[model samples]
Target: MEEKKLNELTNEELLVLKKKSKSTKVINASIIGFCVGIAGYSLFVAGITWPTIFPLLLAVIAYKYLGKNEKAVDAELKSRNLS
Candidate 1:
């Protein structure tokens, strides 16, 4: 589902978002960690190849994409004195 902009969300919705974001943060970190681990393993076993680079790149992209909404929600809440 497409999320409304943080400013457009109601207080209750913002609270819900705050809660959800916390959980999402944990999951996102796990995914990033796993991706990094893969990259590291490939680096050790194969050395400086696409397989090593790809997961590291994927980790960076995943970090940006996954945390995007959570960051916005946090800024919104802090701006509203709700955080």
Candidate 2:
């Protein structure tokens, strides 16, 4: 499908886009937090092991990707004077 430019989207569409962007950010953060909590529980309660590192790494990567997407959304909003 052809992608429409942000400027070409109607106001309602833009609002939906903005809401989705914010929701995605929240979801990513929640996942990262849950992972970190699990990793911590495994480390302190179950004892440290190689498997414990996996959740921590996953959380870090998720956080990094979330930041990148957030920057892109912020830039788009700024360029469009939407936020």
Candidate 3:
């Protein structure tokens, strides 16, 4: 049995991988947002009132921001390798 390497992927396979990675990122972002919002709402209801919504919103924003940073870093590394 042999293991397949990612760089050995065909153009079509690469495209599929790219699309899958994008969708996964979007889905993950959305899930994190929902969890944050819901947890915030719960906290507010529990009388932790003032800070609840702020924390939740910040969590969602931070998660997406970190994801974007990761993608940028990945792109930079790939470009450097190609050059």
Candidate 4:
């Protein structure tokens, strides 16, 4: 699917995108927190091992996805001269 540029989005579309971006940010933070908790629990149960690192990896992926969404929102805001 073709993606529209931030500058090309209508105000209504921008509002939707903004809401989605905020939702994604919250979800990503939750994922990071959950992963950290899992990692800590794994460490306590199994010591420093591969399983302990897996959740950390997931957290990193979530963080990167979060950054991408945030950048899109920032671009939209910048295009609208709101930032």
Report clashes for each candidate as comma-separated counts. 0, 0, 0, 0
Write down the RMSD of candidate 1 (Cα, Å).
1.9
Better of 1 and 3 by TM-score: 1
Arrange candidates, best lDDT first: 1, 4, 2, 3
Residue 67 error for model 1, in Å?
0.7
The sequence of per-residue lDDT tens digits that candidate 4 reaches over residues 1-83 is 12366667777777777777777777778989999999999999999999899999999988876677568767777777765
Show pairs that collide, candidate 2: none
Q: Report clash pairs, candidate 3.
A: none
Segments of candidate 1 deviating more than 4 angstroms: 1-4
Better by TM-score, candidate 4 or 3? 4
Q: Provide the RMSD of all predictions against the true structure, rounded to 1 decimal.
A: 1.9, 3.2, 6.8, 2.2
The estimated TM-scores of all candidates read 0.88, 0.72, 0.47, 0.79
| 1-83 per-residue lDDT for model 1 (tens digits) | 23456678889999997787778888999999999999999999999999999999999999888887877787888888998
Tens digits of lDDT, candidate 2, 9-79: 66666667778777887789899999999999899977888768999999988988767745655566677
Q: Model 4 reaches what TM-score against the true structure?
A: 0.79
User: Which residue pairs collide in model 4, if any?
Assistant: none
